[model samples]
Target: MEELFKGVADPVRREILSLLRLQPLNVNQINEHFGDISRQAVSKHLQLLEESGWIKIYQAGRERYGYLNKTAFYSLKEWLDAYLQWGEQSLENDHGVFLEPTAYEKGAPLTHPVMLQAMLSKDKEFDGLFYNAVRTTGIFCKPSCSANPKPDNVTFYLTRDEALKNGYRACKRCKP
Candidate 1:
């Protein structure tokens, strides 16, 4: 979210995250490390980090402890990883040969070769079976769509939801 991005954009907040990553520290302990700022400033940074879901703040006796919350960071990593994977083509091997997904990634529904062929030929019969996501255009289309995406620029998804979830929108031409 925009708020989440803005939350970590501050240098002080990012430093707080780095500390939390090591171990949970109480407000006083965290405040001691920053020589340039007042305890109130450190607490403000911690509060913003907690509100953004990057860290958790909990009361233990008289002190409030802050710890890294893996969920937000994990989700962030996965979301960014989706774009990284999409951009990679991730298709090359050291041998200078292009590789298709010979082994379907853990839960993927279709083989790359099969889906790639269907997309290249614009096969109508395979429309619902898979969607071709174009990395360059950030669009996903039904295999039946006339879009002729290059092999290296596309990734296949099993459903519209899968494509949308990965940040690709449906092609207006395909209305997928």
Candidate 2:
């Protein structure tokens, strides 16, 4: 558990994980995602991730492909589930309304204003972090969605189901 925490502690490592969440990539491909970091640094991060069981590496002829080992995240998820339950209990007791925890509330960083700016700017790096749901249009879209809506009229959601539950449909453009 401590190893897992250490593995994901760095922002670079987290970004690597985020990239892997989308699809498996070779070390060179992963290194290309970061302009500031050297290939050696990325390789070291990959080694840590592999050691911590957060990722698995396999060779495909000349290239070594790294894929996210999602099962390794289960332990972290279990730990967070306890806190989520506590939060839900606290909310239920205080507000008299049960509100299920959203994915963003669990661990996503999309709640930050900077992340909102990233979404508005169509930053592809944050594509899987959250979805923008336009209240007026009743539609949800990916961060890179081509459809632009007023920021005031948009609410971000952690999942498509959350947006759908709130009466927002998936946008045709981004297909959230």
Candidate 3:
């Protein structure tokens, strides 16, 4: 947990994590975004992030890429959930793509075909009928989330707990 806190403590690291939330990026591409800073500095930050498990660096051919490891956020998510259970104030996320889904209750699991349809359509009716977890991103979201992850990377869960237990974390955007 201390590591997780340190991982997100830096402004530059937070920005890198935010970027990874959207998509994976190779080291050079990540460095390009921080033109004001030396690449060595960014590399150091990446190393720390990796040690903290917030990001996973891998060599994809000759280019090394960084991927977001959402499971690393699970502790934070649980802490937030505890607050929510205590009737703490909710945050209005401007980047959120789904809102109505939060008002619903979790439903039974649906068929794979049905889940696929809901995913593509972003069907609000199926928001709690099933959870859509993206393996590539290691994040799970409500069916109504507007983000379009590849179908090949998606899996279904009957409940958010089920998804979390399987090593996926709730989507920050959807907050599922």
Candidate 4:
């Protein structure tokens, strides 16, 4: 746990983690994002993260890129789960157990109101926005959110029926 914290304690390490989450990047590209830091400093921070098992560095082209090693985050999750489970039990004793298996038990489906209809009547802006919004959730989309991503973790839908069926919600701005 201390090793994990140590790897994450520096601002440079946090920036590296954020960048790697988006995509693997070479040390030079990573350094480009940090104007104040030298390439050597960025390399050192990347090295620490690599040593702590939070990142991986490998040769690509003529340079090495850094990538997030997601498994290390699982270790941090295990540490946090110990205390979270205790709190859950305490809450169960104080109130009644939340027996519901799904957290979205109460959320209503999007109505796709007249406003959405008007928006869709335009040059398919609604569909384009809805598709782009789903990308933020890391899902590949379809004309109608047709389970294109296939896997539940990545699938998203536009219609309330589709979203409710596959467990997605309307975008607050797009209101799919």
Candidate 5:
């Protein structure tokens, strides 16, 4: 746990973990996702993450892929959850700040799909059924969006559970 905390304390390492949490990526692919960083720098970060047991590497085809090791996140989750509780209270006490509906309670498993294939029901209103955020622009989009959606690298979630189940965090602005 100490080693995990040490590795995640760095901002760059956290970024790497967040990316890996989405999907496995090889060294070159990870570098491309974070285009501003030098390849060598990303490699060093991956090395530290591996040493801390936060990530596992496996060979896929011609390249090595890195995956986030869930067990290593246990301690970090506790630390963050402490504040998450406080944030919930703060929001409840102050209606001045708008709070989006959370898909899950702390310590509970996610309930939404990562990508949903459901055809929109004709009668369901778009109010809570469809959601997209400006930050995810060009990423996964709903059929209801006014813009052109991106490639398949992005995904759709049927329920909040499916999204959380697949490790995609909730959007803050346009809460899905």
Candidate 6:
């Protein structure tokens, strides 16, 4: 745990982790993102991250690519979950209603195809997982909403806030 903390302590290392989250990249590719830092410095940071299990390096021919090792952060995630549980309890106490947990809370992958199928089938199982926003009508609905729009005209959002942020209003029927 100390090693993990040390690995993420530097801003440069944190930036590297952020980059890796998007996709794996070789040292040269990673260095391109930072104009001021030398390749050697980035390499050193990579070595520390690898040693701490924050990243895993793969060699393709002469190039070494670093990929984010999400499993390595299980301990860190568990630690954060404790605080999230506390926050949920506090919210419940203040609101007099327990907060409903989303699939994201259980580490379910949010995929478009899965969500689209659920919406098309009116699957109530995915009601809280995501919202279906219609591009043509500019309205978002719960997955089980009776209204069905053409798949091509619909886009799925992880949250109602995300749909609203993209200029979609809640469906009058679903009240999403």
Report lDDT (Cα) of residue 145, candidate 6.
97
Poorest lDDT segment (10 consecutive residues) of candidate 4 = 95-104
Superior by TM-score: candidate 4 or candidate 6: 6
Reference-based lDDT, residue 30, model 4: 91
lDDT of 5 by residue, 60-157 (tens): 78899999887777767887665555355654344222223463234444332311211122111233454432235433233344343333344545
State the RMSD for candidate 3.
19.3
Give TM per candidate: 0.49, 0.50, 0.49, 0.48, 0.44, 0.49
What tens-digit string does per-residue lDDT give for candidate 6 at 57-170? 999999999999987788788876754664445542332222335533445787776677678768676787899999999999998899979999998898889999999999
| lDDT, candidate 4, at 36 | 93
Model 4: per-residue lDDT, tens digit, 27-124?
88898999997878888898999998899999977899888888899999899775455344555232222222232122434233322332323323
Better of 3 and 5 by lDDT: 3
Query: Per-residue lDDT for 42 in model 1?
Result: 88
Stretches of model 5 off by over 4 angstroms after superposition: 78-176
The ten-residue window of minimal lDDT in model 2 covers: 91-100
lDDT, residue 38, model 3: 100
Clashes of 2: 0
Task: Score each candidate by Cα lDDT.
Answer: 0.80, 0.80, 0.84, 0.60, 0.61, 0.84
Q: Residue-wise lDDT of candidate 1 within 132-164, one digit each (tens)?
A: 899999999998797778879898898889999
